[model samples]
Target: MATSRIRERSPKRDSLDDLELPEDYVPYVPLAKRRAQKYQKLIHKKAGLDFGSNYEDGSGSGYDSNDNYRRKNKDQNDSGRDADEDDDEDKQPLTGPQAGISLIEQSVELRKAQLSAEEQKTDVQKAMEEEAKILAAVAERKQLASAEEISKGIVYKDPIKTTWTPPRHIRAMSEEELAATRLKYHIDADGEDMPPVIKAFRDMKFPKPVLDYLKNKGIKMPTPIQMQGLPVALSGRDMIGIAFTGSGKTLSFTLPLVMRALEEETKMPLAKGEGPIGMIVCPSRELARQTYEGFVGIADMLHKGGFAQLKVLLCMGGINMQEQASVFHGGLHIVVATPGRLQDMLNKKKFNLDLCTYMCMDEADRMLDMGFEEEVRTILSYFKHQRQTILYSATMPKKIQDFARSALVKPVTVNVGRAGAANLDVIQEVEYVKQEAKIVYLLECLQKTPPPVLIFAENKNDVDDIQEYLLLKGVETVAIHGSKTQEEREYAINAFKSYQKDVLVATDVASKGLDFAEIHHVILFDMPKEIEDYVHRIGRTGRSGKTGIATTFINMNSSEQILLDLKHLLKEAKQKVPPVLEALEDPMEKYREMGAAGGCGYCGGLGHRVTECPKLEQQQKTKNSGMSRPSERAGNEM
Candidate 1:
C-alpha cells in the first residue's frame, strides 16, 4: 500500500521533457561546448576547409568518419613537412662551420619576409602619407618666400623721405617763438632738434583732405597735445607722447600713421598678403574700434581727394577673425588692433609685419597694466626692419619708460602735462556711501547728472547688478563687461554714444582710450583698487575742453593707500578734497617725509615707494618662479 501511494505521486506531474515545444525551438547546449564548436569552425575555415560541410551534415549532428580522418591526416602531414623544413634550416653540418652560417642566414631571411608582410601599409594610409609630405613641402616653400620678402627690406623706406615737410611758417619759427608756444601749452619736449609746436593742423603739412576733415569737424586749433605731438610725430622721430585722456592723443599718432601708410601705398602699391604698412596697438577692443573708425574717416577724406583708397582693418578679440584675416588678402594699409588678437594672428602666421614701418602703441601704460608687455615685445619681433615707434598714453610710468627705451630708437619725449595727472577739466566729487546703500544712492546720483552718464564699477558683477537695478528703477541703461559678448559691447557703446541710452554701466574695459563725445557725468560705483584706474575712469567725462562732473563713492572698504592717492590727485588738480579722503594716512608717508620721492617711481602709483611696490614684487617673484605672469585684465573686456 505504501509503495502504491509513493508511486501515485503528484498526479503524474508534467516533466520538462514531457512538455510539447515549438517547431523552431532549439535544445540548450553547454556554453563551453558551443564555444569549442565555434572555434573549431573558425580554425577549419582559416585552414582553407569548408567548416560546416567538412565537420557535419546539414542536420549538424552527424559527421563522415572517413572524411574527418583523411583531413586530419593530411593536415598532420603538411605540418610535419613544415617542421622538417624548419629543423633542416636550423641544422648545422657536422664537419663545417660554414654550414652554421648558412642556417642562420636562412632564419634571418624568414624573419625578414614576415616583417615585410606585417609592415605593408594600406592604399588609403599610403595616400595620406604622400599628402602630408606634399603639404610639408608647400609650407617650406611659403616660409622661404616670406623669408626672402623680409630680407629684401622693401618695406623699410627712409623715414626722413617718407615724413612730410612742415610748412614754411612752422619751419621758419624761431626757437624763442617755439619755446613760447611750448610754454603756453605746458609742453615739455626733450629730444635733439625737436620740431616746433604746430599751432594748426595745417602747419604739420598734412594732406589737404586731412585739413579739410579737421575743419569740417570744427577742430579749429590744435589742442595742447596735438600742438607738440603732431610736430614731433611728423618730424620722423620715435616719440613718447604723455598726455591726459581725451587730449587729442589719438589724432597725434593716427594722423602720422595715415600719412606714412599713404606714402607707402602711393610709392609701392600693396600686393595680396603684403601689408599693414602701419599698425596701432590698443589695450582694449573698444579703443581699437574707435581708433579704426577715426582712421577710416580720415582715409575716406583722402580717397575723396583723389588719393589712393586706403584699406584699414580692425583686429581684436570677440570679432570674426576670418573677416579680419580677409583684409590681408587684399592688402590693408593700416591695422588697429588690441595686443591679444594681434599676437594671436602673428603666432598663427595669419599675417606678417614685413611692411609695417609705422607702429603706435596707444594706451601703452594700460597695455602694460594688462600684462601685455611680453605680447607687445613678441609682436615687435615680427617687424623685420626698423619702424617708427610711437607710444601714446594718458600716463607714462617708469615701466613704460623702460619699455619705450628698449622698443624705440632715440625716442622724443613729449609731455603736455605731468604724467599720470588727472584731467583738470573734470570736477571730481567724492562721497562716502556704504556698500549696502550704494544701490539706493546710485539713483540719487543719476538724478543729479544729466543723461549720457557713464557709471563704472571695478567688478563686472557689480556692473551687472547696477545695470539691473537701474533697469528696474525705470532707467534706460545699457551695460558692458568682460562677460558680455562682442556684439553686446558694441551695441551698448553705440547706444550710449548715440544718446539712445541714458546710462551705461561698465567695468574698467571702457575706462581706457574710448572717446564718448559730450558725456555729461561719470559715476564710480565703487572706488577702484588702483589710483590710475580712478584717474582713467573719471577721464571718461570732461573731454575735448568741455567741463564735466565725476562722482565717486567710497567707504571703509576702500584702501587707504588709494584714498591718499586720490586726495593728492584732487589737490594737484585744485579740486575740493573730501575730509574722509584727506584724513586717510598714506602708508608710505614716512618714507616720503624721509626724502623719498612721492609715489612709486617705478609704476607711478602713489600708494607705495618703488621698493615697496606690490606690482614690482610680484614681477620679481614671477620671474624667479619661472612662470609666466597672467594679465590682470586679460579676461576683462566688453
Candidate 2:
C-alpha cells in the first residue's frame, strides 16, 4: 500500500531554492528587533551628510562602504572622496543647542552620577527600605482595624513584631533573684524553693493604674497564688500555678494580661482578630464567657484610668459564628475562647496571633482531659513568641507538667496546697449505698441540707433524671448539661444563681471554671473517675474563705483505689471518715501490693460478679449452719 511514495525515483524541481514565495508571506521579526540591513542601506539618494572626528577614525562610528581610503571619504555612498576635507572640519568643535532641561534638574543628574560612597547605597538596600515602608503602611491599616474591632466587643490581633519597645519596668534579674521572689510566694521549681512572696500588689511593683483597680476591687492583699504568679508573669517568665479553685487564681493571670496589653498598645499597630496581645483559652463555653467577663471588668477599670483602651471577646460554641467572627472585626484586644471555636477561626484565616505576647490557659489540665491538646498546640504555634505563657489549674497532674515543659518556658510553679489535693476547707463525707438506693440517699441529703445545693451526676441522662426526681420530691430544681442549648444552659445557671431554684443538677460541663457563688453543698451521685475531677468537684463548695460540705455516694462498683485515696484524703483534712469506708478491709496483702484486681474476692471464682458467683449461695448456707468450713480458715490464713 505504501509502494508508490517509496519507489518513486523521478524527482520534481520542488527544492527550497525553487519554491515560489507566497503572495502575503512576510519575514518573521522578533519583538523590538531592529534590522541592521535597513539601517546600513542609504535611504537618501541625494547626499550622505558627514559628522567629522567627533567620531574618530576606525572608532567604529563612521559609515563603512565598499571602499576604504584611510582618513578619506571612503564610503562609496559618500557624495565625494576627500581625506582632509572631513577632518579639517571635525577639529573645530561644533557647539549645538540642547533640550530645555532646567539647570536644577541637570545638576541633580550630575550629582547622582558623581555620588560619594557615603551617599550612595546598593539596590538591595534601597529595595529593603521600600519594602519596610510598605510593611509599615500595612501595619498601620491593621492597627486601625483592630482599634475599631475593640469598640464592638471583638478582639483583634496585630503584626507580631510591632515597632513598640518591650516593657522594661521589670528590672533584669538572675534566677537567684527570681528564686527569692518564688520562695516568698512558696513557689516550687524542680525541688528548689523560690524567694519570698510579695504581701501586697504594690510590693510586686504593679503600675499605679493596676494598683488602683485592685484597691477598687477591694483586693488589698494578694492571695498565695497571686502573690507568686503575678511577679513571675510581670517578669515575662512563663508561670505554672497549681492552686485550689476560688483561690483568686483568675486574678493572678488576668492582671498580668491587662498590664502587658496596656503596655503593648503604646507600641504597635493591631488588627481585628489578628494579634490580640493577650489570649485566654478555656475548655468550655461557660468558662470562656466567665473569663471574658472577668477580663472586661479589669479592662474597664484600666480603661477608666486611661491606662489602655482594652476590649475583651468571648469565643464559644452554640453562638452565631458570624457574630463571633464579626466581633473580631471590630477591635478585640483580649480573647477568651474555647478550643474548637478559636481553632475554627484560626483555620479560616479570620484571626491571627502574630503579636500575642501573653497567653494563659485556665483549667489547662481539664483541656487536655477533654482531648484538646492538639488544638491548644496549634494555637500556640500561631504565637511568634509565647512571652509569658501561664497555666492555671485546680490540679497539675504529671501529664500537665509534661505538657508544661513543652508549652511553657522556665515556669515557676506555685502550689497553693498539696498538689492535686482536695480543698482542706470542704468537709467531705462518703456514704455506702447500692445504685438502687442512690435516689433515697440523695433525698435524705436534700431534707437535711439548706438551699443552693449543687448535685453532680456522671452524664446528661443522670442529670435529667435527678433533676426530675428532685422536682417530684417537692424540691425546686434546675438542670444543665452538655446537650442543652447555650441559652437554655444560661437560663438554668441564672435560675440557680438567683435562688429561684433550690437545687441545680449538672454533668461535668458545670464542674470547671464556672463560679457558682455560695454553693452550700456539692453532692456527687456518682463519683468522678479521675482524682482531679474529684478535687474540682469538692472545690465547688468551701470557696472564698467559707466552709461547705461535699458528700459522695460510694458502692462496691467504685474503683477500690479511689475509695482508699478518698479515705486517706478525708483523714488528712481532719474530716470524719465514715464507718462504711473503715469497715471495708483490704482483700489481701497480695492484691494490695501487686495492684491487681484479682478474681472475685467473694466467691473465689475466676470470671464472675461478686453477687452472681456460684460459690456465694454455698458460703451463705455454710454461714447459716454456724459451722466454719475448713476452706474459710484457709482463706483467712491466706
Candidate 3:
C-alpha cells in the first residue's frame, strides 16, 4: 500500500501539449567548477610612494573635508594627547616594520644557494666515486700482481695417469659384508641368483672387448641394479625393472640392450623404414640424449675385435625434424628418442619398427603420467610381436601394470627398495608452512646448504617468481620449465651443472631426465599434485650413493594426504619423520579412543545413536519451556 501511494503521488506526463520546446533561445551550458583555491591577499605598495606615510593619521587645514570631521573629535581627545608626544610623532613620520626585499631577488638568492649545495653534493659524490674506483683499481692491481707472482712461481703438471690396482691384498666381502651391502642398497631380487654377483666383469664372461671397455670406464663391479637386472633383461625375456632414480637404472637397461644388440647380426644398409636394431624411448630430451650417449660410448668400446660400430640416433623435436628424420633415413644401429617425437615420426611413416628387435622405455611411469600412453601404444602397434620389450620405471602404477600385461610376455618384476620410493641416500624432510611463508622458508633452506640447489615449484610461473625473488634477495638463480625454449632450458641446466649457477628453480620438467652430480639439496617449494611427482622431484638429489638433503614446504591443510602418505613412505624407508606429520596421522583414532559407542549417523551427533541422541538435550529444554508457556490454556480447557 505504501509503494502504491508513492507511485500514485509521483508525477506522470498525461499530454504532450504542456511540454516545453525551444523556440528562439540558445541553451546555455554550465561551466565546469574551478579547482584552483583562493589564497590570502598579498599587500602591494604603490610605486614611488612611501610605505610609512600610507598608514599615517595627519593634521590638515580647515579647508580639507577630512580635517573638518577630525576637528569635532580632536578637542574631546585633547586631554589625553601630550604636546611633546604630538611633536615627536609629527617629526617621526610613523615608522613601522622594515619590509623585506623583492621576492625575485630572494628567489634568485635561494636558487643560487640550492645550486651551490647541489654542486657541492655532486662534487663530493663524484670525488667519492673516483676514490672508490681508484681504491678498487689499486686493490685489483695488487691482486693481479700477486696473481702474476704466484703464476710465475707455479709449475704446470700433466694430468696424473693412474693405473688400476686390483685389491689383490684385499679380500672379498664376507657373508656379513655382503648382507650389509645388500641391506644398504635394499636390493630385492627374485631370480635363482644365477649370473651370481661377480667381483670382476671378466668373471661375467662378457666379450673380451666389452670387458676391456668396462675396465677402461672404471667399472670394476656392477651396481646392485646392474647386478640383479642384467640377468633378467639379458635372458631374452620381457622384464620390469623398478629402481630408484640415478641408482644406475640407465646402465641396467643400456648394458642389456647393448649386449643383445651385439649378439644379433648387423643388417647392412638397414631398410628405408627399418632403423636401429634397438630403440630406447625416454620421457624427455635430456634423458634421450643421455641414453644415446651411453649407447654410443658402449658401441665405441665394442667396435674393436670384429664387433661392428653402433650408430645411434637421438630423436627429439626441439631441433630440426629434418635432422632427426635424416638419421632414420640412413642406417642406424640404435635409436634413442622421446615418446612424443617418436610417435610423430611413426605417424609420418618416417621409420619402421619391424627391425627394432630390442625396445626399452626408460622412465615409463613418467612417460605415461605425461599423457603419452596413447602415443606409446601407437608406437608399439608398429612393432612385431617377436621383439623383446622391457619397461623401466621408478614407480609402477595400475596403468603401468595394465600396459605391461598387454605389452610384455610373462615378465620378471625386479624391484629395488619400494616402487615410488625415493633414494635411501636422500634425507627427506618436510615442514608444515603457510603459502605466504614458503619463499622465506625456501630462502632459509637454501642458506642451510651450499651452492647447486635444485628447487622444485608446482608450475612455470611459480618457478620464475621464486627465481626472481631470490635474485632480488642477492642470490643468483636460474630456472627451467617447459615454457622456456630448448636452448634456454639447456643453458639453465648446463649452468646449474657447471656450478656457474648456484641455485636452480624449476618445474617438474627437470625432475626426471637431467641429473646433476653435485646437487647437494632438493627443495620442493610447493607440494606436487601427485604422490609420484613427489618421488621424482626429490629424487634429483642423493644420487649414486652420495648422501643429499631434500626439503619440502607443505601447508598443513593442503598437504594432509601428501604428508600422511609421505610419512608412511618415509617411515617405511627408515627416514626421519617430522612431528607435524606424526600429529596429523589418523585423526579418526582420537574419536575411537573417546569410547563413543555408535555415534549418530543421521545428524552426525556424537556419543549416542540417532534414536536416543544426547544432542537432543537443547531441544528438550525448548520443549519443556513451550509446555510451561501453555499452562494457562490447559487450565482454561480443564
The numbered model that scores best in lDDT is 1
Q: Using TM-score, give the best candidate's number.
A: 1
Candidate 2 has what TM-score?
0.62
Rank list by lDDT: 1, 2, 3
Per-residue error for 476 in candidate 1, Å, reads: 0.8
Alpha carbon deviation, residue 116, candidate 3 (Å): 99
The better-scoring model by lDDT among 1 and 2 is: 1
Stretches of candidate 2 off by over 4 Å are 1-196, 207-218, 268-274, 324-326, 586-638
* Model 3 misplaced regions, further than 4 Å: 1-186, 190-200, 207-218, 265-273, 303-307, 324-330, 587-638
Global lDDT of each model?
0.76, 0.65, 0.62
lDDT of 2 by residue, 1-638 (tens): 47787657646775777777774343343322222212221221113434322122323343445334334333311433332343443343321121234568878887877786426765544444554454343223112112223245443222122222223433344667766766765656542323344557776656677787778766779877876666666666666788887788888888777767776665653555455778898877767777888887777777777665676777777776666555566456788888777888778776677767778888886675454655676675566443467788987654356546554545567787766667777888888889999987898887656889999987778888998888888889998876677788888888888899899998777788788767879999987755556778888888866788898998877766556556656765788988877765644334435454433333122222233333334435655786544331221111
TM-score-sorted candidate list, best first: 1, 2, 3
**lDDT of each residue in 342-396, candidate 3, tens digit only:** 8777777776776776788888766654545556666766764356677887776
